[model samples]
Target chain A: MNTTLTERILGGDVRSAGRLMRWVDDDLPEARHELAALYPHTGRAYLVGVTGNPGSGKSTLVNALVAHLRASGKTVGVVAVDPTSPFSGGAILGDRVRMQQHSLDRGVFIRSVATRGNLGGISRSTPAMVQVLDAMGFDVVIIETVGVGQDEVDIVRLADTNIVVTVPGLGDDVQAEKAGLMEIADIFVINKSDQTGADRLLRELRTMLHLRPRDAATEWTPPVLKTIAVRDEGIDTLLTNIEAHTSWLSAHGARHQRDRTRAQQFVRLIVTEALSHRLNHALASSDWQSTLDALLARTQNPHDAADALLNAILEPR
Target chain B: MSQEPKPRTYRVLIGKPGLDGHDRGAKVIARALRDAGFEVIYSGLHQTPEMLVRIALQEDVDCIGLSILSGAHNTLMPEIVRLLEAEGAGDIFVFGGGIIPENDIGPLKEAGVRAIFTPGTPTTEVIEYLREACANRYQ
Candidate 1:
C-alpha cells in the first residue's frame, strides 16, 4: 500500500500528493515516513517566492506568472499562504480567486495554507509541501506569502529566487528600505506600473539598489521590473529576469549553497519540533508540576525552576 | 502509559459549486468554522463537482461543506458524493448548505450527503454538528 501510494505520488498523482501534504499539516508520523521514502526524488523544482505589501497585487502577479510559465509548457505548483484567523483559526484563501483561470488545467496544482499562527507569512509545513510537489515532478514551485511583514522574509530561506513586489503610491524610498525585504529580494517588481507614482517608485528603488554595497561574489544585481499584472502586462520580462536569475544561481554554483541552507533550516525545524514535544511531555510530569507549584508559592524563583527543568530534561538522556 | 495523541485540527474545504456566484453563506460558514478552530480552505464560487472533489482530494480535507444556491444542489451534491466515492475517498464526510429546500434534503442525504443545513440555520448549530461529525469521522 505504501509503495503503491508513493509510486502514484511520484508519478504525479495530485491526490496522493495532497494526502501527503495533509499529513504534513497535521504533523503525522506518516508524513515523515513518506517523505523519507520520497526524499531521493526531490531537489529538482525551482522555488520562487513572491511577497509584498497587501495591496501590491502579489497574487495577481503570480497568476500572470503562472500563465506565462504554462505557456512555456512547464508544470507549476503554487502554495499560497494566507494568515490564519486568530479568532476562528480559519483562512479565506482568496488568492485562489485571482488564479482561478488555472483551476481546470491539470498542469497546475494550487493549494492554500493558513499560517497557523506562524509568524512568517509561510506555513510551518511549506517546505515539506514544496518538497512533495518537487518529488511529484513539478518543473516550478511558487510560494506566495501572506503579504509583507518583517517575519515574511522567511521565504528567502526556502526559495531560490525571491521577488519583492511593490507598487507605487504606497510609500517613498525610506519605506522600502525599512523592511527586511530589501536584503533578500533577488528580483524586485513594481507591480501596478500604470499607477500615478510608479515612475518615482521605480527611480527610487534603482537609486536605493545603487547605493547599497554590492556583494563581491554576487554577480546578479536585483532588477526592478514594472508590471501591470491584472492586464497580464510585462509578465514575459518578469519571467525572463527570473530565468536569468535561476541561470545565474546554477552557473555560479550558488544553487548548492542555497539548497544547503534550506536543508539546514529543515533540520533545525525538525529539531525544534522534537525538543518542543519533549518539553511539553516533561512539563506534564509530577516533578515539574511541583516545581511550578513551588514557583507559584514563591518558594522557588522562575529562573532557577526553569534551569532545573532544563538540566533535568537535557541531562545525558 | 504513553500520552494520548493531540487532537489534530480539522481541515475543511468550504466549496461553492455550480454557477451560483452567491458566496455569502459559504464565507460565513468558513469564518464560523475557522473561529471554532477548524482550518478551512475556502474554494471560491463557480466550482464544478469534479473540481470540488479534486480540491477535497488535494487538500485532504476531513469534510467538505458544499454551498449551492443555483438550484443545482440535487445534481451537484450527489455528483460530488459520487466522485468522492469513485476516487476511493468516500471516507471524506460530505455535507452541504445553501438554498436547499426541505423536500430535496432527504434525497441529498440518501445520495450520501451526511447532513444538510438550509438558510436561517444558526452558525453555532452548524459548528456543533461539525464538531461532532468531525470528531467521529474516520482519520
Candidate 2:
C-alpha cells in the first residue's frame, strides 16, 4: 500500500504537491525524478504570466483575477516570486498578504519562491513548480514575477498568455519604445486607471500599437485594457480578454508551437545545468589545480588552459 | 558525486493572528529573519487561526511564528496548533511572540508551541533558536 509522491499528487493531495514544490526549490534529486514522472500529466493547465513594476498593484490585480476565475468554477494555483537579498540570501515574501481571501479555499494553492540569484523575473525552479501545479489538475496556473520594468522577458517563453501590467503614471508609454517589455506582452493592462493620467497613458499605448509594423489582417493585436484592480473593476473584462487570447492561440496553432519551444528550452536548460555541475566538480580536482598553477606561472596561456580543461571534461575517458 | 546535499532554506510564517492591528513588532521580526537568511512569509495583520494554518500548509514552511499583542495568545496560539495538527501538519514547528504573560508560556508550549519570545527579546535570539530548533526537527 505504498503510494509514491507522484501518485499522491495526481490523486489530489495538496500536502504532497506542496512538499514537491519545496523539493524543487531546494534542487533535490528526488524532485527531479518525481517531475519526470509527472511531466506527462502537465500542459493541461493554462499558464498566465503577470509582470509589472514595483508598486504597480500586480498582486492586487492577480487576487482579483483569481477571484473572477473561481467564480467561473475553475481551480487556481499561484507561484509568486520575490527577490532574495543579494547580501544575506534571505527574502521576505509578502505577496500572500494581498491574496489572503483565497487562503481558506481548498481549490486554490499559492506558493511563494525566492529568486535566489536568478537574473530573470522568475526563480530558476519556477517552470518545475508550474509543472507540479499543472499535474495537480489546477485549471489555471498564474505566475506573478518579482516586480520588473524592462528587459525581463523570460516569462514570454514559459507562459501561454503573457500579460504585462503597467500603471498610468509610470511613463510606461515612452519606456515601451525601449523594446523589451513592449515586444513580449501578449496583452497590456493599465491598472490603477482611476488616476489622473489614465487616458493619456491609454492614448499613448494605442498610438504606439497603431504605429508598429505588422500584418494587421492576420496578426493578433495585443489589446490595452484599463482597470482599477483594488475595487475589482474591469476584472471580468480582463478575464474575457485573457480567454479570448487563449482561444486565439489554439485557433491559430500557436499553442502547439509555444509548447514545443518550452519543451526545447527546458531540455536545453537541464543539459546546461548538468554540464555546469560536472565542470565545477572537475575544476576542484588536483589536475585542474596544476593547470591553474601553470597559468599563474605564465607557462600556460589562458586560452590554452581553457582548451585543455574543456577537452579533459568533454572527452570520454 | 557523493557531496553533501545543501541545507534546506527554512521558511517561517510570521502571522498576526486575532484582532491585533499593530504589526510593527511582526514586521521587525520578519525583516530580521530575512537578514538571517530564512525565507519569511508575512501574513500581514488581522489573520485568523484558520487562515494562518492554511497559509502554513500551502507554503510548506518549517515554522509558524505567531505575533499577537491583544492578550488573546492563550486562545489563538493553541487554536493554530490544533488546526495544523488537524490538517496532518503537526510536524511543522509553531512558535509565538509579542505581549504574552509569563504565566501563559508554559500552557502554550504544552499545547505544542515549541517556543515564545516575549517583547524586548533580541531578534538574534529568535533567529538562533529557530536555526537550532528547525535543524533538530528536520534532521
Candidate 3:
C-alpha cells in the first residue's frame, strides 16, 4: 500500500496525493524519503508564483489563469498557502472555497499548505509540495499566496515566473511601491479593471517599470494586463504574458535560475533546522524552562544564562 | 425496541472543483465532519474534473460532498457528473453546498445532485443527510 501510494502519486492519482499530504503532516520519516526519491521526476512543470496583498483578488485571478490553461489543453497544479492563526495554530484555508470549479477535472490538482510561522511566505513543507506537483507531471503549477508581505515576496524566488496581482482603490499601488513589489513582477496584472483608478494604477505601474533596467529581459519585457477576474475578462492576455515569461526564462537558462532559487531554499531550511536542533539539544537540554522562572524572579540574568547555555553546547559532549 | 448507544460513523470526500480560493467553508466543514465521526479525504481546492473523479474512484468513498463557491458550478459540476458516470463511479452519491442561490438549486438537482446545502445549513443537517444516504446506498 505504501509503495502503491508513491506510485499513484507519480501517476497523478488524487487519492494518493491526499493520503501523502497527511503522511507529510504527520512527519512520517519514510514519506520524506520516498518524496526525496521522487524529486528528480520534478523540474518538468512550469512553476508560476502569484502573490499580492490579502483581498487583492489573487484567488480570482488564479481561477481565471487555470481556466485559460485548461482551455489551452494543459494540466495544472495549484498550491494555495494560507496563514496559520497564531492563537489557534490551525490552518485557515478559507481561500480554497473560492475556486471550486475544477473539482471534477482530472488534470488539475490543488493543495493548501499552512504557513506555520515560516518567514519567507510559506510553510517549511511548501517547496517540497511544489516538487510533488511537478513530479506528478503537471504542465503548470500556480502558487497563490496568503498575501504580499516581505515573506510573500520571497515566494517569487522559488518560481520560474512571478506574477504580482494588484487591484485598484486599496492604496495597493502605493503599498506596492513601498513594498518593493515592482522588483519581482514578471507580469503585473491589474485586476478589477472595471473599477476606476485601475488605468491610473496601470500607468503608475508602467512608469515604475520604465525607471528600472529590466531584471531579466528576453523577447518580451514584463507586460501589465488589465483584468476583471470576477467576470473572467482579459485572462487570456495575462496567461499569454505568463507563457511568454516562461519560454523566455527557459531560453535564458532557467536551470541556473532554479539552482539559485533552490540553493536559497535549502539554505533557509538548513539554517532553520540547525537552529532548531541547537534549541532542542543545546539549550533545552539544560533546565532552561525553569531557569526563565529564576530570571523572572530576578535571581539570574537571562543574558548571562543564555550565554551559559550556548557555551555548554559549544563545549560539545 | 431500538438498540442503545449506536456507533455513528460516516465517510465523505470533501472536494473542490475549479479555482475558487474561498475554502473557509470547506475547511470548516472538514473539521465539523471529523468531529462528527466521518473519515474525510478532502481533495483540497483547484481540483480538475479528472482529478476529482480519480480520487473518488480510489477512495471508494460513499459520498462526494463538493464545496463550490466560485459560481462556476454550472460549468463544472455537470462535467464532473458525466466523468463520474464514464468512470463507472455512477453508484457513488454526489451533492454540492456553498454560496449557491435559490434559482440555481433546481438546475443542480435536475443535473442529479442529491441535495444542495446553501449557507446557514447546519453541519448537523449535512451529517444526518449523509448518514441516511450512506445507509440507503448500503441497503
Which of the numbered candidates is closest to the native, going by highest lDDT?
2
Candidate 3: lDDT over CA atoms?
A: 0.74
Better of 2 and 3 by lDDT: 2
Ten-residue region with minimum lDDT total, candidate 1 chain A: A88-97
Please give the RMSD to the true structure for each candidate, in Å. Answer: 3.0, 2.4, 8.4
TM-scores of chain B alone in all candidate structures, in the order given:
0.93, 0.93, 0.90
Worst 10 residues of 3 chain A by lDDT: A87-96
lDDT of 3 by residue, A1-317 (tens): 45656787897776557545545543455567768777779778888889876787998888888988999999999888777655544443545455667655778777766666666666676777777778888999898877845535667667878888878887755677778677777888888888989889989888877776755544346788899998999988887787777677768886477767775775787567756777777545448877777899999997888887777656654
* Candidate closest to the true structure, highest DockQ: 2
lDDT of 2 by residue, A186-270 (tens): 8899999999999998899889988989886667899999999999998999999999999999898999999998888788878
Where does candidate 2 clash, by residue pair? none
Q: lDDT by residue for model 2 over B1-139, one digit each (tens)?
A: 0222434798899999999799999999999999999999999888999999888878888889999999999999999999988988888889999999999999999998999999889999999999998777655
Question: Ranking by DockQ, best first?
Answer: 2, 1, 3
TM-score of candidate 3 relative to the true fold: 0.68
Better of 1 and 2 by DockQ: 2
TM-score of chain A of each: 0.94, 0.95, 0.86
lDDT of each: 0.87, 0.90, 0.74
